[model samples]
Target: MTAMEQGGTGMAGARRLRQPAARPTWLPPGSIAFCLRSWAAVMLALGAAFWLQIDSPASAGVTVMILSQPLRGQILSKALYRMAGTLAGAVVAIGLVAAFGQDRIMFLGGVALWLGLCVVLGTLARDFRAYGALLAGYTVAIIGIGCIDRPEDVFTVAIFRVSAIMIGIVSIAIVNDVTGSPTAWHRLAAGLRRGAAEVGQIAHDAVNGRATPDDGAWLDLAARIMALTSQVSFARTELADSALRMTGARSAMVAMLDMISCSRAIGGVLPAGAVRPAILAAVRRRFGDGTPFADEDAARQALNDLLHAAPADAPPTPAEAYLIERTMALLSYGRWVRDGIRTLEEGRAAPRVARDVRIARQQDPVLALLNGAPVMTGFAAAALICVLGGLPGTTTTLLQVATILTLSITTFDTRAFGIGALVGVPLSTVCAMVLDTRILPYGSGLPFLALMLAPVIFAGCLLLIHPRLMPVGLNFGVFFFIVLGLDNVHNYDPTQFVDRNLHYMLSAVILFFALTLAPPSARRRRFRIASAVATTLRRQFIGRGDIASPALISRQYDRLLQARTWTGHLPRKPATLRVFDRIVSLGDLNGALARARRHLARAAAIPAVAGQVARTQAMLRALHGPDAAGRLLDQAAHLLAAAGHLPPADRETLLGAVSGLFGAARLLDRNARALRHYGILPPPEAAP
Candidate 1:
């Protein structure tokens, strides 16, 4: 009945006391795309776009642009660079072919060398920053390999390729704009609301001293919310339109993220004892009393009124100063997002806001450098193919390679490296056979082909409904179709087509290997594991009240969360959050480990072991707040070393003691034994 009371309730009582989950209309949006879905959508879109031409259509690149828009600004950014690189490479090819006649083998050799450099560039690219550089290099390959004997026709193809690329960019941008585009404000608003709800739930659980499986789920939910918060800030800064739509969207989204962040921070500080009764009452209503705060008529009415319009009453309670501070921050981001949308609708440029928005910018200079590295390599590769491989057509070959490589850089997914290789080879031959050999000479084929290709109209209208893939997938499919005309393998020796495809495939694969292995994977997996500790702690701390406050559990999780951002080179995607979740689960395992040690130590009546568990809990509390961790972890280490000399069955005891302590060190600070690789943890000053 009161905060201090306890009941000898079994699991049956717990379940009976628990309220059913709220919301009768809560239809799940389902999950994000699986690897298979991503693969299929990409292949499907390309098949549809390039059914007419054996030489790939730029439409594939463009479609990737539209489909990738949900990832913030990256999708279009990739397309833009690829288009530029393809055009530049095409023009350069025209010049090279014109200066040297098709009869000269040396001229073709130069082209092959140039394309090799492009592959290296693609290899170095971390993200879209390297896309253009890769494009510049591959441009040589497309030109060299595809143009072959009809060197004079390089100019005509170059012009057409550029035109096709423009069509693709426009198509993606327009389709994105028309399809009730996901405004920054909408996303930000949703994230803020979600974050706020999490804070509320966490505070209620914290005060009432309750922990449930849902709490663990909630922690995962919170980490994801942080990701959305990051997105809101990015929108406020990175949006291109600069119109009312963009401004309004950014404003609203920013407001929501900032507000909820502040609100949660304050709510986290509330003492567990203060709000316990009110929470139990709410839970009781949801179960026995048939009324819950969030779901009941009274609380829902109060919430609706509060949100329906800002209250005209005096300022909030002192308990809510933090909440109001959070509210103001939320309002700022919300307003910016709202203003952006309105600005877009009005067809106006940005109208200055009362205050400036702060942007966290770390546009890596290294990414640009890495992107540039491939140019020299690509040129060398291009030169080789031109001379030794006898690619009479250098420019078109180089153009295709450059464009595809550039387009592929949009995704951070490791697997996509292979897609670039598989897509480019056969498509290169197909384009060479159909457009290079068959269509232009007849002159009659061009008009008919153009008419037949007009089905781009349907693709344009239903771009969103088509298969979804990373930008690279669509690029590969389109290029595969584009270069390989519709069923023309028989015209050339089927083996020759296959052989050439394999050759180019090897070339692309070689390029991919070159680019990626250059820097190696930086090996950030450990850091991800560390950051997961923090996320897990937050979830356990906020949601699980029944579980005793095991400090090492908290410490281990905090360490995981803290390790998340230590990778000095920040990536554009939210994919890193997945790594954090995995590591945090490991933190949960550590808790079980500590509990087992506690049972064993209590049985043995080892004061040293008892001291170690206490110290471990102390370390966990300090994990959340730096100052509190002092001397606790050291004691854990000392106790474990003492336990190490015990008997064989005592192996579990000694191992648990040492392993748990080591895990604690990993969680506590970057300089700690386990986290030394991160190299950014501050000296253990207490958290303010």
Candidate 2:
């Protein structure tokens, strides 16, 4: 009786284990809502365009697809830029058409040149601003080149195009409002708070001399922090008091950068067990909860006490002085972090202590030119082929090429964009074909059309939400409406469908080849960024770099973040790792020099301190070996001794200057070997 029962029971249990767990609702609520919102916008756009009898009802739907963002703020912000870009491009298109209407070749060349210029600008810009530049570039191709045969209708075409885009924008806005879509400010505030906590932990760990994070970890964290640059911009459009909120956000970002730099500097100079236990405990208790200090004055006093807590019997070493300096910095910046989050949450004016910070972006003219040249060359070549080939729909083919190249410049990985196009356009074509011939043919009326579109729009939105699938989803979502060939009157001809698909596929192939020929080189970019860091360090060594300010700190963070991002794209080789390390060291050195100069400026009024500071600055200009570092440390100690005679505020300021000198010497010693290898520091024999 037991053997048969046990065997049956075991088999049943196995079957139960093999069964899937209810699939756990494959799509998240947010994604599902996004998909539904996008589909509704598309429908409303198309319906309005068709009712108005616009020349390109499909464009309205395409606009909706392109503007599909999860946050209402993003959609509104992008929509504003899109409208501006379209209007600007349309005006240029009219002028180009008027000047070269009788000369098609000249007209195409003019459009290509305009496209190239826009690509360059787009490459230089960031966030939605870049999108605007790219859109303006392609809009000319859509408006001017599109009317090569019907030059007289260029104005009419521009008007219709603008009209369709307006329809799309209005449709999306209404749908978003009706749906009560999420705001960017809410998400941004949450992200800022979370980032503050993580950064606070890093600083706390560094001050307490815990296991410090590696270079890559710090870089990664910086990148994450820098990414909020775009969110801050988007969130500015979400509220009426956006200026104040953005000010706070910017302050928070700057503070976070300062905190990281201090953390890295402290970790490098302050050895384990250097800080007194009581000071360490105070630091731990302050940051333990990951919240801003309740009282700024009280916190500053507490930190100041820790700075003086070193026994009177034993004078503070260079490491101890630097620790105190960075700890004080942590307190001040930590207050800004708290104030910024509060402003963002409550939509109030940020505290007067919170300075408005702007994160700088690195612009490489060489990289921008590299990105623009291929786009221009590819567009011209495609235009030439289309013009000479004299194909029935060559204009459409050229348009596709122009659009793809212009859009590709906005992305970091042109090859991935090309691949996405290669896969997405055809998939879109196939779906469009099936929908047109099989699905739409069996159905009629607007409701039926909307029903047929729902699933495809939903699928594209679903994929768009995923990072890996975003490129493909973006191409598919935008091109599906374009390829579907929807019009005021439906045309069910298979020949036209095949011809249009072939044109788009040809353009996709061209994009793939163009990008493959001169793909953006991650290795080259990494090297270039490293070279930039070295150059900045060279300037710092010569006392020519910008003084440490919010702006300077923000720029340093940007460059380091860019290096880290590019390094991730490269193969994990020892040489690459060394370059990355060298870049970080150079950056830290530059920050040290800048901070030293700033502190020197603050305390320069004191004649004795001024003379010593001047000598230390002279030594930095010839920074070379450990001998130089040791001498610099001696000078810093002298500066610290002078600090005791000043008032409390002046004393703290002088201490910071001394600490900066100490930090600089320590970094020079630590990275001396690598600096020598990179020619940033001279070898022992070359030392003056």
Candidate 3:
């Protein structure tokens, strides 16, 4: 059966149709279980804090809420980083207080500089590690600024904050473990299997020449796998067999990338008449047959037999030979995918896949430094307002404002997140008053409080799962509990509650105005991000690095994905899509160049082939410089065309590589000119 037919009806088809499980009223799915467990842990931490007579129990509560993510492993990992950041920030706060305690101007200036540096570092680090940098940055603001009036109490406040955070972390880890929260290993396995299936399908499509290899699906898959690495680290700490599982899952990710590269290569080389029905049948069976091939050896032998035995109506040519070579590479990568799955499923270590090629993400240091400006300016402005207003109890609220703005603005659109806070604070304030005055006043036990909280907590957890509603849910949920201020000694003062709510609302407003002033518009942000990707692509072509070919290609694809997501919200303009397509095309050509270089490493009978290969590399480097990129490309094409005319019998091996180079260079030249139209490539200086 063909791949389409194989994907059809009944019990077999049910596996492909993934529907969300029907959630019952009483029971929670795995993710919600995580949320529920986190709430319980926070409550327990609060109890411990109160029992021990900690000065600020609310700090512990906030720590637990911030560390709470859907995945247990992520929570565990983040908790560790949070503690490290807290300790580091405490040290810095103590030192800063000692150096500039008496000089208010110097102290505030030092704090601003520190916050700006952290934001810059966070922007440079793109993954989970960025969280650690951000936490460290804002922690100093939280602790140092809070202790400005009483420098002597800096040590005492730092001790209390660290101790409380530790209690919360330990509590959450214990509760999550005891409650059997879903493990990260299972998530990793699911992602690997899904990726393998996708690679298989893409391979099948490529063999039939029905593939658009540069589409977004492959980029999404790569991004998902990259995002899972932190979770995998957490899983290794929890499950003993997780180390082997991580290896296998990682191999599967790399193999999927390899399959994509090979698919494009084969698609380019395979002639219209070269691929027969038998070849397509074999590919379909290999991918969708619903049965394992027993081993890589068996799968290879079967593919070999199909290729050798299939009828070819046309005479042999260079394209047909190249097709066979790339087909072999495709089958080899497909087998790796199978072995990786087997290894993950059976808890056996798979053979090591060579990933010596490092993927380098190019970040513009200047832009990163500039991105820190808005964040720092907003923070500085908030501090200035609070110091000048000179209102009692405003210091605490101002610290909260600075903390929220610094963290949120770094990761998201400043205005949008501030707006979410603006909407969420009032809703939470009303809920807090009703629960504290109306519901909890008559009750006197922990059980009554838990019962009252269940509904609100459940609702928040439900909203957190929705993509669009998450910001609102998080802002409301976290601030709601803080506003309630549940304590051992209940103080039912309506006036105090009203006053506190007003301060919070005012603080959020101050932050909103601070962020909105001279904000980067959506159009500008999209343009900058797209330009960054283009700049990175250029660097990849010109700069010599040890990055792996597959990884390099995958990183470029991921950047383009980010750019595409941004452009989706902008006005529909063909120039954006056209520029994106050119980047995609250029990336493919670069990959082809890398592969051609590797082919030249093997001995060839014709010496002239090596010279053509070197010439192509030089042309690619010149294209990177954007100086006469089109002219250099034409020169490379001439060299390849001359090499193509060499005697076919003696230069059989070199001729295929030569033809590949000529095609890729011509495509690169066309894309470079398109990029010039958008001013991505350096424009020619106006004629003097």
Candidate 4:
């Protein structure tokens, strides 16, 4: 159908039909090609499943539908997860059935606990890893729920389900690989270039005093770069050379991020002066006014010249020295970017770059536990209703409901899927009804069924690949076919079909309420995460000096980066920016304190330095009540300075601790909201 003709279906349908971006001239329209490939793969899988006489041949099609993705890497990653989740789920199902087969209540309770645990675990993982957790969560329901009448058949059901999924996965993999869908390396290259250009522009701007980089934007971009590192393995599977190219791309991306951080660090320390302006002009002249540096050699040459011209008699101050080093680091950073791009282009190994400090992620077990409440409650309610109402053959429907919720649980936005199911499931049901009652005869063979079903499958897959349409399209399309429950031996009873759909509809309703009524909305989830991050930083700062491990702080920063990415669409001006800066300041303080503590330990034989360390530690511990932050910071600084008579290395450590203390104090004074969040003085406006 023409785009216009397809869109005429209505607003919701039109949204599904709308492609987010136009396809390239060199490539066939990707959606059309993807749709066709997916249809063919599903057909092959279905044929294989039916020919082999698997119990649920339609599951083969569902598998294909689930695995259909536009990129080769996405398909591979998803297929791997599908296999892992299926296997894990099957194993758990067998255990659950074995343990409590005699007591339906016990079995149901066990299933709910298992599903909840999976949901909790899934929320802790990132991206498709989370999907795997969700898949494992509901796969238990799919296997165990259906076998409730005969627990002995759970193993058989698990095997058939896994076998059908494997067939679909293998079919799609072979087709997608042979069809030459774009490799992950191409996307990796694009990501590298984009990140380099962005960081380069920010560096260029900082030199010229045009604009400082936005903390949120920088963190969001860094998080995206970090995310790309995970896709490297997926790229290697696409082609032999992709591994080398992707590795180089990843190195370059990390170096670019470090460059941004260095630039920000220098900007924070250096005051605007004649030297600063001269350096900015030299950088602007070399990098060409806010564009990516095109000539690494010339840029390096210019920066070297600028460094050499520094007056020998000029006062050697820490800030000026740091600025000079930052400039040199920027030059080195640009060269790495250049080498990385060249490596990707030539399919060669990238030069090794220093690994940036890994971002840290801290999980709130409370949040994870809360995340599962909806999934667990939904399953429990569905089971209770099924048992209490004595609804025969409705267990499968409850499983579907739990499966939908389990899938939705890992997403940043759960309501989208819940809403998608409400629309997609019923839409699919209608389409299935039309095909069964009007178009296809009661006893069509496999080939005939594939022929008649091609359009539906094709259209569904088309929508599945559309970026804007994915949630609705996939949910609607897959569930539509699944709820229809087509079989090798056709039982085209309209009453049965209608009855199944009603149960499916009811399932969707339960999921909708579960997601809507219990779990936090997207904004709320973001806020909770952000709050947790702020709270974590506060605790680290006030707690024992040793609490801030490099690894632990890295995780907290990583979580902050994730929060920044999630809330990128939030307006730039707000407490969000202030809060983020404070969190980062705390992180820096934690690291600095850790470094100083290590140095102080080496010099602890000196009684004076040891005494000063003890004093700072006491004040830090007392940093709790309102107005304590500023007072404790001042006291810590005094105690830090009292170590001046210590060995040179220990004195340096004391200086570093003082510097970190000053940074925390500045953050509190500058951002009143941040201070208030940490139980400091009243906010700026409210201060008497």
Tens digits of per-residue lDDT, candidate 2, 462-551, equal 878877677899889999999998999988988878977788888888878886677888888877787877887877766677778777
Quality of model 1 by C-alpha lDDT: 0.41
lDDT of 3 by residue, 28-92 (tens): 45656766786797778877877887767766676777777677777777887788778887888
Each candidate's lDDT (Cα)?
Answer: 0.41, 0.79, 0.62, 0.65
Clashing pairs in 2: none
Local lDDT at 477 for model 4: 73
List candidate 2 stretches off by more than 4 Å: 1-26, 272-300, 350-353, 617-627, 673-688
- For model 2, the run of ten residues with the poorest summed lDDT: 1-10
TM-score of 1: 0.45
Query: What TM-score quantifies how close candidate 3 is to the native fold?
Result: 0.81
- 2 versus 4: better TM-score goes to: 2
**lDDT by residue for model 1 over 1-688, one digit each (tens)?**
0001111212432242244665532122211222223233333343444553533454354344333445334435566666777776777677677777555556555554555455455544434435566566556446644565677667666665565565555545555454434455456555555544544443333223343223234334434543553454334433554434444433433333332232233233243222233333332232221112222243333322332232335322212222222222233333444444345345364442313333222223344344444544554554456457665334444444454444444444424454445543444445555553555345443245444333332222223223333233353444444444333222444554554444455456545654455432323434434544444444332222123122332333334433443332446355655554435434544453343244334424554455555555444433433432234345444554454344433433443344334333333432233222332222346221
After superposing all C-alphas onto the true structure, candidate 4 shows an RMSD in angstroms of 9.2
Off by over 4 Å in 3: 1-28, 211-226, 241-244, 264-318, 355-364, 486-490, 516-550, 601-663, 675-688
Tens digits of per-residue lDDT, candidate 4, 1-688, equal: 0000000011332232232656633224677788778888888898898889998788999989988887898888888888999899999989988988888999999889888999898878765677788898789989988888899899899999999999999999988878887767777777777777777766665554444544545555666666676666566666667655655665576567656655565455544352455554554465454333345455444544554444545432233333444555566667777677777778765454323423335666777888888778888898888788877788877788778877876565566677778778888888899988887865467778778888888778766666556677877778766877877787778998887778888887877777666556445555666666556545544554454333443454466665665555466777767655555654454444443344445444557767666766655544443464476466544644464345444444454455445444434444455555555333334332
What is the number of backbone collisions in each predicted candidate, taken in the order shown? Answer: 117, 0, 2, 6
Name the lDDT of candidate 3.
0.62
